[model samples]
Target: MIGCRHRLRMDAAHGRELRDVVEDSGVRQRREAAAAHRASVRDTLIAAAPDAWVVIDPELRAGARAEATVRACEAGAQWIWGALLPQEPDTGRRGGSEILMRDTDRGGYIPIIVVNHKVTDPRRPGPADFHPLTSELSRWNPQPDKSRKLRQQPRDQQRLAHLYRMLQRHGLASPSLLGGVIGLQADRILVHDIAGVLDDYDRRYADRIAVVRGQSPTTPAKVPECRQCPWWTRGAEGASCEQWLTERHHVSLVAPGSRAEVLRGHGVTTIEELAAWTGEAPQDWQHGPFDEAVVTARAWLAGAPLVRRFETVRVQRADVEVDVDLESYQEHGAYLWGTLLDGRYRPFLTWDPLPTTDEGRSFGEFWTWLMSVRAAARAAGKTFAAYCYSRTAEDKWLYESAERFAGMPGVPTVEQVREFVDGPEWVDMFQAVTEQFICPNGKGLKKVAPVAGFSWRDPEAGGEASMSWYRLAVGYDGPPDLGQRTRLLEYNEDDVRATLALREWMSPRQPTAHSAVEQVPSLADFALDPRATPARTPAPVTASGGGTLST
Candidate 1:
């Protein structure tokens, strides 16, 4: 219910899922592991509670929900594990909770879900304070001040709202309208005021129900959600959203989200129309500058994925440059630091599963090596810079590893990380790309690097796939998979190499060369046709593949 609306509509229509050789085994493993963790935590949480009516039936047999309801009504047992709440079909809400506890009033039960991600940072201030041992949820009282502010996990809030509404329908909900979630740290249950998010959940659910009932058309719009959606590129039974967008040269092919919709309202539906647009801005235009949008559309049509924003394009380069890439498993410590300097690909990695003691040791070694390289460059009086595709992920671990392993030898201090990140010595290639060029096709390393003639050795070199490989490599449950470990190392190495390739391509080490902008086609070069070339011969068939055209 909380997923993509298009996916929901398709599911309601019994749409066939994409049957491609998808790499979902790792995703499956992650889900399974999370479920296992949730189950283990739930068991531990309710173990000390008195007579917790544990529902073990996975199928929720004929009388399971009934029995659970009867037990919940008793109110004697404060904790109920694996609760199968009664379904409210009219409201389109039905689900089970990992743990349901008696509300503060004890008049009804409130839902508690166990999730894989962290719900709150103890270091930060939040809305509620919960005690796991007693399962008590105390609302924030500024007088005493004990809160770990809400951690932007809207799905959990929506889910709690869903369960709360279900409880209300059954006459077993408190007026307080609250719920709880036990995150990765099982010691704490981050309770929430479900009342705050109920309206949002209601609005979303009502709209999704309309979509499911075919009352709303699931028109595919090019957005962030489309990346993981199966209906992208192609669907199981129809021409995909990709095909539809391409055929019309949809403005969204370049401009994302509501920008394209707003453009359409201005009679600019296709990329060609947007490129040709020379009119003044609408009275209340809030979308970005008209000039930039037109330039992007022109870039898209000309197949120049990136267009220079100015006459001159430059990237920060140094005599001694190191391309860096860091890999981590979903919120678990960063396990690998891959660096490409000169021509060598050196990797600092831990073979053990992440969140292990060895992670600190590995990180310490990597930090020491990196600093040594910088120190050597300074000693030689040669300028130095370390480059990463994006600094956000790398910057996070750099500071966290320091804080996480404060006393560990060789671990860089938070101040050191801050200095490096803030200084010009640490260059972000993605930021450079953003500053120097407008990328119509999007600026992801995988998307932009290929334009710079960089390709990964592994076809499936992505964060998602790496997670599964990490699990197998570390032997999460069984013997170590050496092949997977090798794959991970290779992937990490290639990532660093890709960044290096992008760096050299953007700002060549050679004294004189055509910059990225000078090397690619410009709008004038595509006067006849966006894709046309002077040396190109026309294709034998028609655009629709109906018949051969006379050359």
Candidate 2:
């Protein structure tokens, strides 16, 4: 209910066909690392505690374990170390939170989940998210703390609610409806009000139950989750939603989500139908450029990957431009900052394991180098700019790095980071592509960069693979693989290079005659003068039979 419906369908109907994306992704390893971190935190928390806790043996049988837990609850054990709990009989919903503490007033328990991400920030003077609790000095005692604003983790809260439901069913819930979270910093416990999230949880839970019971629609829609879903793989006969959509050239290929549904409502069932469409758009149409969407479909039909929305390509370009790409390890820190300038790739990175204090050195070096580049460009009266595919991740790390290493040598102040990012000189090429072109497929850097004739050296060059490589390169799990370090550098270099290539290709005048306006078809190529044209029926864009793309 919370995620992809298509994946839900796959799990329900063809549970065995889902493929684990292990060939080039690090999701499994990353999950393992997270689990390890959670366990380590749990171990330390339990180790530091007094003698009032109850630790159940995980190896015990279900019935036996349930009995043990019941015994502990009956005895009013102050703490339950593990998150595991007994399954309920009626709904069969069963899961555990990391830690459970006895609610003194309520005579039951509430969970304190161990999470590997930040749950709160230093907040302003306002109503507090929680009363801070320390285990040793202030165990079970929440003290006044108005400086913490909770980071809303609805999913986690939903999990807490799920556990709450199960506990309530089993008569083990705290009447207060409170839960706690131990985030990455583990500085203090942030008590969460489960009642606040219970309504949303109930709604989601009911919907999901409907989905599981075949009472709700299981039709697939193209969502971000589709890219990572194992069921999206090929050769599931007619089961793979990805194969089904791509092979049929689903209208969602161009007009995704609600727009695709809207098109279907108007008899534009396929991309071909949308492409051949010559009538007025729906009276209630509000989606971006209905005509531009038709052109995108036409581009897809013409086997063109991209369609030019504007006649002459326009993108920000500087006399001395630098392409930038940052590589990060989970939520720890950015380990590498790769930059390209003067046709040279410079990688300022740390070989020391992540979360190390030495991360400051690498970050400081990178910032100092980048600032020098900008300073020199301004001093010489040459325009300077930096490019990245997207600003979200880079901006996050930039701001975070500044905060994390504020007083380090060469580390810029937060204001400096803010000024640079907000400036027009820091260009996000992805934004430029979305503004200027109609990509029949998605407008991801990997997809769009290929249109600009840029390719990574390694076929496995992707964020997922980089994570696995980073682990090996930094010896996170074992002895450092030097080969992966080189591979990482090459990958980062290619990413920055890809950004530069894409920017140049979008430029109207460049050394290479590969400008998008010249290479790709403009709207004029397949566009019909709607006022002068008559209505036309859709031609078959694919083979004879195919299923509908939406519910």
Candidate 3:
């Protein structure tokens, strides 16, 4: 019989509408409908029999009393039926099994069944998969006495043991019919005996709740809850009190970790206090004096010396250079690859994805042009190099395009692409920066670009933001916003220019110390081809504007 399942909040009006639809459909198939209705009516009549069954919908506040009533019935209620509810607020705990266990002392045997209508996927298993009928029941015999006693164990343990027995009864079962009647779908089932784990979790949860409510003075040894805890705002305005104490006072960075306890033991609480305490290093402390010194310097200095081990800032002079940056949609593939050759910015764009003539077509065209430029440089006895901020995306896409279109005429072979990536012809400024210095701010192109006096025209432009623009450009959700494409191109241009700026800053010709204003030589001054057009010279602004250099 088909049961009309709905939420507890569903009003009588909605129920009437559903009943009308069912009745109208049932009338169309008269004989079959009558049989189905009879079965449903009979089931309802049997369920209504005095103390035969107790049904509860635990999602509603009223369900608590329903559950209490079911518990009060003791052995009289032979069946406990429940509708799966949303988990408890904030705690994420499910109340179905917990409600059933309300009367632990008055335990007899009640076959519990929970209906979960939220599961729509046919492949997914239902409650029957987890708690199958016993083998004795399958053989048309009564359940054993031992099996009845097993139900008195903890809910998790009882369910797990039942599943284990069912599995054993079926002899390493298949997804089809396990016994004469029941089936087990292997792909969509998960069962675990987690009674001990649940007990531990419950104990810990109680302890944490006690700490949060200030009923206990002692904090829990773990503070993973700090991120989501409402009490996180208790300390400072801008930063958490915990963070402020940790940073300023050399306290252990990780809450509840032994380092903070160690520091407190030694009375080296604040940074100033720690600095003064030149006592023998605590054997338990993870960091040494050298690490402390580095942190102290960073805290005090506006521009601390670069961490040399991580830095490799040296100049590699090239006769002809092209600062290259690629812009691509991860799903749709690379669309725009911008190249700054001798200050002139050029972009190869693909707006469509027609096979053999889209992103692939654009890559092929760009590769051919690049090859020609390199060939010209080689013939002139000059070295040509393509520089990108990072090798990850651009290098990956170049190799991918090469491999994808290996047989296509004019596209580079995989071996050639590999050579270009591995050789000196392709330079990654990210590697250059990493080899030269450790940046506390970050190693991202945006982070390091500012150090080299580089900035984007559009503040919102970023790798992820560009992908969002690409989505709009391709009309993925709605009509394409062409303006987004222009903004994306501008962002890409800024990226390539940032790499050029970094290269200039790292040049050995520049002063060693950070300068308020360093003259940056124009790419035109080092152009290999006299015929190539120079970039348009903008009106001279401050050094930050990144205009053409006089020097």
Candidate 4:
């Protein structure tokens, strides 16, 4: 409630959030140069369009762009195309990205027809984030929606539906640069945000725009839209993933001077330490025969927070940070798994299906409660909060009974705990919680929870515990009556309880401010002169699947 007005005012800007304003202005200037470069490339492409081809500028308010472009695409004219030529690289980066989307709803992909620019390493040619330009090939094709059906329904129609609904409820526009890239699709998914596709229901309604909900059948082999993302190939190998480790080491583990000395000892006095260590190396090295300094280095990094911990050494401003994690169903659809801080663990909420009545519960049922808690937190002005959600699938029963229970409200409001369900903004708030705040080493709850004094290593609080320990206090055998369901509710409640407990437990001890080089041995070199480091090249890291561990 307190920051609501500020958030509202800021949200008014649509694509241009506060982070767009940089202190050095150099990044912005570079972005401007890149934009100019793109414009030149684009002009050469546009001039090449055939005489009869039709062009449409689908630039609406920020988030609304996708729907508008979708509308243009549905026109079915032989040459339907659009362009998002902003004047800055980062400026309207969101807007440009939104406009570049194709009908991803039905596993359809917009193809990139041209690339006038040269990309760096072909191994990692694309930016870290996917960049889809299939929608931008507008100049080559005829106007979309040539048929009478095109006139009756347009891609933007779904967007308009969402826009009107959002306007009615919040009087604010979608924060997306191109209206919810997957509008109306928000309701289906548990983690509803622009990063993911719309739910199945809304995708069905999106006639012109094809849905890309499940795993793409045609895995482009190379990364998509992310290739152009700033995070893509920009940092050292594992730099993005190791950001949390680096920051944690800087703020929590090694003292600045000692850290510098250690890195220098490795001949990695620069940011080029990409090959000098792996995030897990410290732990790995400790087992081997290493000198005390090296051992200390390993020890320090092993204990760092899961998220990025260091502040921008050069910039002085309000520091923003967010700790996040996700939870989902695992086995028997009763238990769920959570991913945070680069670690995956089990959350104990589960329900046993019964023949008489209760069979399978939907994610929405649990999510409703989570949303209410978040609403309560927002209403209370809590900061640096962490959530643990299980990231697992549901039972077959859950999928079969979907229609009747599809939109059923789960979490109860002040009026009725199960009456008022939260809207997408509530979900968006969770999504924005990170973007508004910095994430460590690209880590969130899974990684950070462990480092911030949480120990799944032990059972009493954070150690290994049984899945049954999380089950309803009562035995699972039952008629699936309300009494049994109540126990299940308690099981779910314990998760929130533990999450809050961890947040409270970790709160006071959080690094109050950035550790000065003098304080942290690991951050000494970075603190000494952050600017001295050259661009880092990272060693290729092969991602491993979830490790088998019980908690």
How would you order the candidates by lDDT, starting with the best?
Answer: 2, 1, 3, 4
TM-score of each: 0.84, 0.83, 0.49, 0.26
Tally clashing residue pairs in candidate 4.
90
Q: Write the per-residue lDDT of candidate 4 for residues 409-509, one digit (tens) a residue.
A: 55122323223222212122223223222222333333333332333422332111233233223244333355434433443344444343334333333
Model 1, 1-551: lDDT tens digits are: 46667777876785545444474665576688698788778566556553545554566684676566556556555666777777666866778777776654546777788899877654445444542221333222212225444457888888899888887877777676867787886766676778878889889989998998899987666877777666776564477778977888878888877787688788877887877776576555576676677777766655556666655567888989999999998777899999999989999889888779898998999999999999999999999999998899999899889999988989988888889899989999999988877777788888777766777888999888898888889999799999998999999888888888777776777736545436544434333443322232222212112332232
Better of 1 and 3 by lDDT: 1
Per-residue lDDT value at 439 in model 2: 81
List model 2 lDDT by residue over 1-551, tens digit each.
Answer: 36776576557766664455343356586567678778777677667875767887778887777778778878888887664777765564777777778889868888788887787777657664464433321286665566766677766778889888878887889998988878777778877678988888888887776776677886666766666667666445475677788778788877877787788788776777787777777776688778888777776766666667777887887889999999998888999999999899999989999888788899999999999999999999999999998889999999999999999999999999999999988999989989888887678888877766677799988898788899899897899999999999999999998888777777833455443346566666666643332133222222112321110
- C-alpha local distance difference test of each model: 0.74, 0.77, 0.50, 0.30
**Candidate 2's TM-score:** 0.83
Instruction: Give me the runs in candidate 2 sitting further than 4 Å from their true place.
Output: 12-24, 118-152, 188-192, 196-200, 210-217, 234-237, 247-251, 255-298, 508-516, 523-551
Clashes of 2: 2
Write down the worst ten-residue block by lDDT for model 4.
183-192
Best by TM-score: 1
Better candidate by TM-score, 1 or 4: 1
